[model samples]
Target: MDESLLSIMEVREDLMVSPIGDSEPALRSAYFLKPIAKSLDGPVSKVLSSSMTMSLPPVFEPKDWPLVIHFDWRRHTKKKWVEWVDALQLRYKSVWKKVGIFEAIMSIKCSIAKDQNLCFGIAEKWCAETNTLLFPWGEATITLEDVMVLGGYPVVGDPVFAPLQSHEMREAEKKLILAREQLWRRTKAKASLSAWMDAFVNSGSEVEHEAFLATWLSMIGFSSKGLVSTLVFPIAVHLARGNPIALGPAVLASIYKDLTLLKNSIVGMTKQLVLGDKLELEVTLQSPFYLVQIWVWERFKNLQPQPRLINHEDPMMFRWHKVKALKIDNVRLALESAMEHFCWRPYVQYAGKFKVFYPENETLVLIDTDLDKEPTGLLVSFATCLRVSLLVGIQSTIKKYLPHRVAMQFGMDQDVPSCLPRFDGTKDFAWKNYCRPISDRSLYFPARLFEGDITTRYAKWWKRSLMGHQDFAKNMGHQDFAKNIVRRKRSPRSPQVSKANKNGNVDDDSNARKRNSDVDAPSGFLLKRLKTVSSGNSAQDGTIANESIDAYVPTCKNLSNPSSSASTAEYENVKRISPLTKLLAKDTVEPLMGRLEEDFEDANGSKESRLSSERVSLSGTQGESYTF
Candidate 1:
C-alpha cells in the first residue's frame, strides 16, 4: 500500500471507541455469547465417537428466562396506574425527544461535514461517547443528501484576493480598441497619401510640357483659321522622346474631342481652345496642377461670349482690357480677347526652328525658342526670343492684308511707325530715360527685350549717366589737332634759321627776327568733316580723295642742321601718316633716315615709351638740348 494510505489505516486503528458504564457489560456479553443446544445432530454424534477432541471455550447453555430487570407493575398498578398515565405520556414524549435529538445530531454532523470536513469529522468520530457530545440546540436540520447537494468538493484554501477597479479595467479595454482603430486608419491614410504623392511627382515633366502646349494653343487662336498640322506635331515629338505613356490616351482623346467640336462648330473658336478643348482633351495628363490651371483658364473663357474687336487698324490691339473689366453675367471675356488678338502662328513656326511642329489655329502660335524638347522642354537659356521674333514678321504681314472687318474683329490697329529712325530713336531713348515697362506682366520680357545691342547701348548710357557727363565730341578718334598743338609747344623756332645755319650762311639778327616771327604763328587749327548718305532710290556709293603727299615729305635742309622747328616739322609729318604707312615706315625709314627715323620712332612708339624716354633724358642730361 502507499505510505499515505498505510498512515490513514494506522490512524483509523488507533481511534478508541468507549462504551457507556451500565450498557458496557451487556453489550460485551451480547457480543461474546455463543448458543450450544444440539440433540442427536450429526455433528454431536461424530464428536462422541471421536477418540480425542480438542478443548474449546465453554458455550452458554440455554437459560429459562430469569426476569432480573422487571417493572413493579401489580403492586404499583393502582398507584402506578395513575402514575402510569402520566408516566406513559412522559415516556412517549422522552422517546420522541431522544429520537429528535439523535436526528438533530446526525443532521448537524452531516451539515458540518458537508460545509467543513475537518470540524464535522473531528466532532463525530473523535468523541468519547455519542451522548457526551452536544450540538447547538434548535440548529436548523439538514439531511445528509441535502448537505451533499449544497457542497460539492471543497476548494483548496486561497491566500490572495487582489481586487481590480471597474473603471481601470474598462479604461484598459477602451484603450486597446482605440489603438487598434487608430493604427488601422493611419495605415490606410498613409497608403493613400503615398499613392497620391507618387502620381503627383511622377507627372511633373508631362505637366510642364502640357502647360507650354496650352499656352501655345491659346496664342495660336488669334490669327489663322486652319487645323494647322505643324502646331500639333510637337506633341508627337514629345511623346516619341519617352515621356510617360499614361498621358497619351487622354491627350489624344482631348485633341480629338476638341478638333471634332471645332469642326462641327458646337462651340465658338475661343471656347474651343480655352475651355471645351482642354476639359475634353487630355494633353500631358501627368501633372494635375498644370492640368487644373489649364482647365480653370478654359472654363474662365467658356463663360464669355465671343470676343469682338471694333477697331480695324492694329491687329495687335487685343480687346482684353474690356473683357477683364466687364462683369455682367458669369462671362470672362479677357481670354477670348487674348485668343482673338495674340499671334499664336509664330509659335508654331518658332517650334519649327527647333524641328518641332504643332497644329495651327486661327491665330499664330508663338513657340518660345528657348524651350528644349527633351527632358521636358526647358527653354535654352539665351536663344529663345530671336527665334520667336523671326516668325512675328510673317504673322504681321498676314494680318495686314486680311479684310478690314475681319481685322477689326481681331482688334488690329495699323498705326506702325512710319520712320525707322524716329521709331528706333524714340524706343531706345524712351528705354534709356525710363525703365522698360513689363510686357504682358511676364517676368522674362525685360531680359528678352534689352539683350545684345540694346543691352550694350543701355550699359554705355548708364555709365555716362552715372559719370554725370555725355561724350559730346562726334569724332573722338581724331588726335591730329592735339598732336599739332603739342608739336608747336615743343618747337617755338623758325625752320628757315635751322636751314641757313646748316649751310653756314645765317646772320644772327636775321635768324633772331625769323625765330620771333615763327613764334608768333598760330599753334594749331582743327578741321572737321561731316559725311552723310542720302536716302534716295538711286543706289549711289561715294568716295572722296584728298591727296596731299607733298606736305608729308621731309627735306634734308630741315633734317641735317636740326633745331626745335625742324624736329617739330618732322613730328608733324609722322603724326599725319596713316597707321598702315607708319607700320611700313618703321622698316623703310630706319635705313633711309637713321637719326631722324630714330627721333620719329621714339616720339611715335607709345605714351608709356615716350614718358620713359623723357624720364631717362631728364636724368641723363639735366639742361642740354639734343635735337634730331
Candidate 2:
C-alpha cells in the first residue's frame, strides 16, 4: 500500500505493541506497514471520520506539511512536504533531543502526532526505527536505550546527574532514598559515621555497601598509581538545608586516620561478593588511575551487557552491579565544588562515602593538574536531574546544548579534563561506551527513575504486591481514596459507641445517640409502610427513611404540648406514605428536605431543652435543705 492510504488511526493500530519484560533480550522483528484510511477522500483530508483531523503540530512549519494548515490557511504540495521531512531528518538526527522539561516536551511530540492525522509519517518513522509502539491516548512503551539508538547514540553504564540549580539538584536527591535506608542502619539513627565506619563490614545494604567499597577501592587504585583526581564530592547536610536529606551521617575521613579500617571494609565486601555469598564479581582495571566496578553487590546476569573499550582499539566486556564538575570553554581544571568538602582533599584526592553527579569509567584521566578557567554563568538547565539507566540515551537528543566550538572541543576530546564538568559528561560516557557496534536491536539500560516515571511504576508495583497487607492503604498517601481501593487500613466506624461507653465518658456522643434514637425507632415501622407506597423501583428511597424525623415544631407551645410527639410522628409518616407520588412527581425532594431543616429546631433547641428539664424543677419550692 502507498503512504497515501496510511491514515493516523491505521498507523496507531500498526504500532500497537505487546509488553516484553526488561529481562528479555531485545530483538528486531518485521512490522506490517499497510494503508489504513479506507474511507478517506484524500491523503490530507481536513476531516477523517468524525474525530481525527489533518493538521500538522506547532513544531512543524507550514512549508513542511502537505495539508492546508489552518494557522494561516496556507497549503503545500506533497513534493515540498517530503523535502521538509528530509530537512528535519537531516537536521535532527536523534530523538533524545531535550526529552525533559517541566512537562517533557520531547515525549509530547509523539502525543501530538498520535492525535493529528498529518503527522502519521513522522510517527511511522519513529516507531519503525526505534522498535517502539505508539499506544492509544498518547502513551508509548519505550526504554531509554530505544530513544538513544533512534537518535544514533551509545548506551553508557552507571548513570548519574549533575543538577546546577537548587531545585534540580534537590530533585536529584531521590537517588539517595535506598542508600539512606542503608546509611540509617549503619549509623543506628545517631547520624554518626565515626561509629558507623568502625563496623562497615557489618552494614547490611548490599547495594550501597558494594558501591561504597568499589568507589573507595577505585580511588585507592588511582591513588596507588600516583594520580590525583578531584571528581568525588561529599554532598553535605548544611549544603542541603530546608529539605535536609538523610545521607546518613557525614564521615569526614582524614589522611591521618588509620588506613587499616578502610582496607578491612573493602576486603570484607569483596570477599562477601566472591566467597561468602558465592557471588562472582568482575572489575576492569581501566588503568592504575581508573577502576570500573559495581557500586554494590549486583547480580551479573540481571544487568545489561557491560561493554568496555579496554584497548579503545579492541573492545572488551565486563559486568557488575550498577546502581560532576563544572567548567568553562577554555583552560581545563576541576569545577569548583558546589557542595562543601569537609573530608580530606589531600592534593585533590578523596576517601570514604561521597556523592558525585555522574558515573565515569574506572580509567579516569587527569591531565593539566595546574590549569584553571573561569565559569561563564551558564547553569545546568534541567527540570529534573534523573539517574538514567543509560546515560548515553541522552546522546543523540537533537539539541546538543553546548555553548560553542571552544566548549565542545574541550569537552568532546576525552584527553582534556580542564573543561567544565557537566559539558564533559555529555560527551565522555557516549565516547567511552563505544565497545562495539550494536546492530541487532536497540540495547537498553536499566535506567531506573529516582524522580519520574520509574518511581510511579515502583509505587504501582508495591500497590499490587502488598495487596492484602492491612496498613498498606494508610501508607500509600491516598487515605481519602482508600475507600475505593481494594483494602482499607482502618476498621469500619460502627463500634465507636460501645468503646466510648466503656471508657465512662458521658460526652456529647451519648446525648446525641439518645436524641437520635427516635429516628431509628420509627424506621422499623416506616420501611414496612414504605413498601406499600412505592412501586418497588426506588432502591435509594430507603436511605431517606433512616433519616425521617418526628416533626417540624416551630413554636415552644408545640414542644410543650402532650400530643406533639404523636402529631410529629404522624406528620412524617404521612410524608412517607406518598413517597413516590409526591416526591417523584414534582421532583421537589431536595426543596422539601430543605424546608424540613429550616422549620426544624431539634438540632438547635434539643440541648437547651434537655439542660432545662434536667435543671431543678423548683415548682415554687426551695430544695429540701430547709433553711438550716
lDDT of 1 by residue, 1-628 (tens): 1121111000000111111001111000000000111232344223212111211112111121110111111111122122322322332334322221112111111100011111111112111110011111000011111111111100111101112235643343343334334534656633221222222222444332222222222222311221111232233223222222112112222322222322223123224444434333221111111111222222222222222221221111121112232233211122212221122111111121212121111111112112122221111111111111100111111001111111111111111001101122232232221111111100011100000001112222222322221121110111111112212232211111111234333234344344434223222211111111112221222211242323222112221112323232232222111111001011111111100100011111111111111211201124422221
Q: Each candidate: how many clashes?
A: 39, 16
Best by TM-score: 2
lDDT values, one for every candidate = 0.19, 0.19
Candidate 2 lDDT for residue 402: 15
TM-score for each predicted model, relative to the true structure: 0.14, 0.15
lDDT tens digits, residues 1-628, model 2?
1222111000011111111111111111111111112331242122111111112132323233332211100111223322322333333323212111101111111101111221221222122211221111111222221122121111221221222346554443443334445556766644222222333323443323222322332232212222111122122211222221111000101110111222223234434544436443322221211011110001011111221111111101111111001112210010111001111011010001011111111011111111121011000100001111112211122111111111101111000001112223443443332211211110011101000011112223323323433332222211221122323221111111111123433235445455543322121011111001122221221222333222210001111112233322232222111111011121111100000000111111121211111212111223421100
How displaced is residue 68 in candidate 2, in Å? 65
Supply candidate 1's per-residue lDDT for 342.
21
Model 1, residue 490: displacement in angstroms?
A: 74
